[model samples]
Target: MHPARRSAGWMQTRFFVMKKKLLSLILTGLGILVLPNAALGAEPKTIGELVTKISNALYSAMSGIVLIAWIVIAFLYLTAWGSPEKLKTAHHAVIWAAVGTAILVLYKSIEPIIKNALGV
Candidate 1:
């Protein structure tokens, strides 16, 4: 009877752990994909015709920035692992990332450029 009770407890613990892990993954993915969009004035909707709805100009630009950043990060990560050639690719990614970051910073300082380029 004691052994059966122990087995039951172990199963319950394993179930709880799995549930926690699944929830964590879901929340993390949501944070990466949706948080910045919301923060930047973009709303994500599954029911709508379009995927994302942009509310304001600044918000839209921010969402664009967020998207670009994530893509760059993904690219950098994709090349960061494995052989020497990949490492060199990662190094170039890092350099491009630095340039991108500089551009982003300049963009913040100079809104007129984006406004003019966007024709807004």
Candidate 2:
């Protein structure tokens, strides 16, 4: 065999091996990321349980965000220090925040009724 041909063949083989290893690593990482803790031997949740857990998490997160925003609005008002522009900006923020909170409440209130109507 010619030396140049032998080297080319070796390089091709190495590239194939590296490609396979890279694909394997990606699939393994994806498996770890996607699998739930329960799939690893803990108790698995039912569909309803999963839905409830996800909903609760979303509700809690939204409530916490609204509370934090209100606190921020309060600080903005306190530090306005007689500036009309700052107070006006804070007032606009409060109005938007209240609207967001109302939407969140409306969703929570309607979700259960919708679920019941749909028999889910």
- Candidate 2 per-residue lDDT, tens place, 1-120, comes to 999999878976886686578557755654554344334443326655555555655665666567657766876786676899999999999998999799788867766775576577
Q: What TM-score would each prediction reach against the true structure?
A: 0.35, 0.56
lDDT at residue 27 of model 1 (Cα atoms): 55
lDDT tens digits by residue: candidate 1, 62-119: 4455555555556556535566876777677667767766766565545555445565
Model 2: worst 10 consecutive residues (lDDT sum): 35-44
TM-score of 1: 0.35
Worst 10 residues of 1 by lDDT: 47-56
Please give the distance, in angstroms, between residue 73's alpha carbon in candidate 1 and its true position after superposition. Answer: 4.9
Report clashes for each candidate as comma-separated counts.
0, 0
The numbered model that scores best in TM-score is: 2
